[model samples]
Target: MVLAVRKSVEWGITAAKLFVRRECRILSTLPEKQEYAEKQIERAPSGRKSITKKSILESRHIYPEFLPDPNPNWRNSLREKLEREDMLKRRGQVEIPEFYVGSVLAVTISDPHAQSKTNKFVGICIERKGCGLRADFTLRNVVDHQGVEVRYDLYDPTIQKIQVLRLEKRLDDKLLYLRDSLPEYSTFPFDMDQEILPEGSEVPVNPIQVVLKPKPWVERWERQELKGIANIEEYLTEKNKIKRELRKTPWEKYDLMKQYRKTIPIEDQKEIWTEVYTQLHQLQSAQKKMSRKRVFTSPKSLLA
Candidate 1:
């Protein structure tokens, strides 16, 4: 006869507790103010053990990287609990929204000392860079006869709200070259407001090509993939090909670092995303309640 191993939800939760207990044990073994303790041991050695143990436990909060990747082992229950706490911390402060590159956004960030506690910056997102807490987006707009670009971390503490004024896409991944291009293409009216598209509507396209300035720009325009370059073939010469050869990759030098930064690890994906899914469901429930409240208060609904 063969026997099967039965799994239980209670067991999973228990395993998680044990995991944290083990971490505490490892942390406790670390030298607890050995240098300072040595002097105290010589002076008043009576309650040395008691004071040192208390100090070790009390100072646990100051340990760096207290929040780390779920687990060293093939993740057990404890990892899930830590992940939930992290997600809740993120939720308590800023409300992150669903957004993508090429969307026009008005980001209001808190500036306490300013005349108004909020400062709003409106621009079109040209590109998204990185993932997780490191994720950031680049916003571009023309101001004072010059193009201006600002990169903001998606999860940064300063951002109050991110309103999608216009959700759209461009032909290229990044529109950084727009810096050296004609200001007219990048410019938008300062007073432009959000354009709310109907649900399931198609994303708009910005097919405008911008003209570039004379030589000596911030970047070698040729190195970047730019769609706005109308006369690219005309600009190309023997010099461009020579430059490409000089910049040849020497056997993928960045393979290890690139892999390290990539965020799609299979096991971590499950635990990290678990809390997000729960919070999203909670947000949906709260929105439903607000909708119900509004319907009851409306003058037309009350009359009917």
Candidate 2:
């Protein structure tokens, strides 16, 4: 019994010594491992860093229409899949360039009544709404001193060409307020030249604020908080200001449920973009090649 107890105590001491040695080795290597990790992080390429931070999910801003309606009532997975297929087919047919509400666009559509069987209109995009194939955009321009607005179906078969003369964003998502503002704000020359941005440049935002026309406007501009309008306060009375303040829902921004309802889930968005990214990339490459060819041949043609 004495020998057995002595053996047990010896084993316990041996085990404790082994544990201490193991812990000491780990502690000695910890700084080296940490330094190696820091070096790896520092040496990482920016492209890989960007991939980790911004994946295919960033494509959402470029192709927002590809996302299905977030409304649970309107959501039909099969229908959305079908719509996506149709939208891809239409996109294959038409090279619809990236554009925003404030961008200048020139659209040419097949018109049976037109002398040339095609009609071209140039204007500033005032609004873009809807999802899937039902998506549409409105363009406003002053022609012959009269304000004219044209609404066109984005994926219409009749659309021959969609050109972005100027690709830029406005302060507001929708520029419908331009309709009530000065005609100059909505106007664009029909022969406006395309402003080609350098490759990989971010879309520029126009911060120009518009002056609104006096009362008797189309909509109650005072009720809506418009960042692109400058002279809205001049048109608003004390009562109007009070009503505007009363209508403000400061808590809406903090309402996660409302945001969730308005946008598709990130995981779902990744899946959708993953399926379409390859095709979109191919289309973009083809377009770039064609554009380069055109640029090179144009000068020679002009000289000839």
Candidate 3:
């Protein structure tokens, strides 16, 4: 009976010790101490502020192709993986600047027919379509009273240079209707000088509205509800305007599911950027170093 009583007393002491240890842990995790710990963490050498909304937007611009097609039927993880690999490989070979529809571009490509074995064209981008390896853009310009539109594949290996002479956005996304408009609207000089924007400044959007030529147009411009064209009404008859009004589906704008299906979710975009950011950052750093070297180095003839 004395031995049994000693065992129970030992059990009680062990339980008390566990309770005191837990209490000490709880005290250590109190609100004040927790805040102090967080402060210390924020002040750590490798700590960084949370990613800003601006940074996310900038990533969206710099890595636009990284966002997979929003079409549910077209999405395939393996295909996207292969495409990104190809895109990165191409990027390593050439520098593709961030440009949008209505931005003037100068593209130099190897041409067997040309005497110099190279040809260069400059025009305003009218459309950008397709994705991955198939991505391409159309540039329209008036050369010697003739309208010339050249479509170039973004990943084409023969492209020597793709320079943006004027970097600006348009009020509308696709400027394909520029074809039906007057030639002057799409005209850009071949030797147009680069309009350099101040570093860290926001890209300007050209708000000028284009005037379209008299019908028949390539498409129903009135139905498209284009914001970039100003004189659309002058070309439309009363019946045409009425038809356009009847065709308008204003309720489609409020269709939440449609927008969700057509756009990449913010979470998905963040995850994608996380995977691509490091590799792209490294590539950009290397390009910067190479460019600096080229700028510093001079030809022997120039030195002489």
The numbered model that scores best in lDDT is 2
Give the worst 10-residue stretch by lDDT in candidate 2: 295-304
Candidate 1, 158-205: lDDT as tens digits: 888776666666656677776776677677766765554544444545
- RMSD, one per candidate, in order: 19.8, 14.7, 16.0
- Reference-based lDDT, each prediction: 0.56, 0.76, 0.74
Using TM-score as the measure, which candidate wins?
2
Q: Which candidate would rank higher by TM-score, 2 or 3?
A: 2
Q: Candidate 3: how many backbone clashes? A: 0
> For model 2, which pairs clash?
none
**Native-to-model Cα distance after best TM-score fit, residue 36 in candidate 3, in Å:** 37
Worst 10 residues of 3 by lDDT: 295-304
Worst 10 residues of 1 by lDDT: 295-304
Error of 2 at 146 (Å): 1.4
Backbone clashes in candidate 2 total: 0
Ranking by TM-score: 2, 3, 1
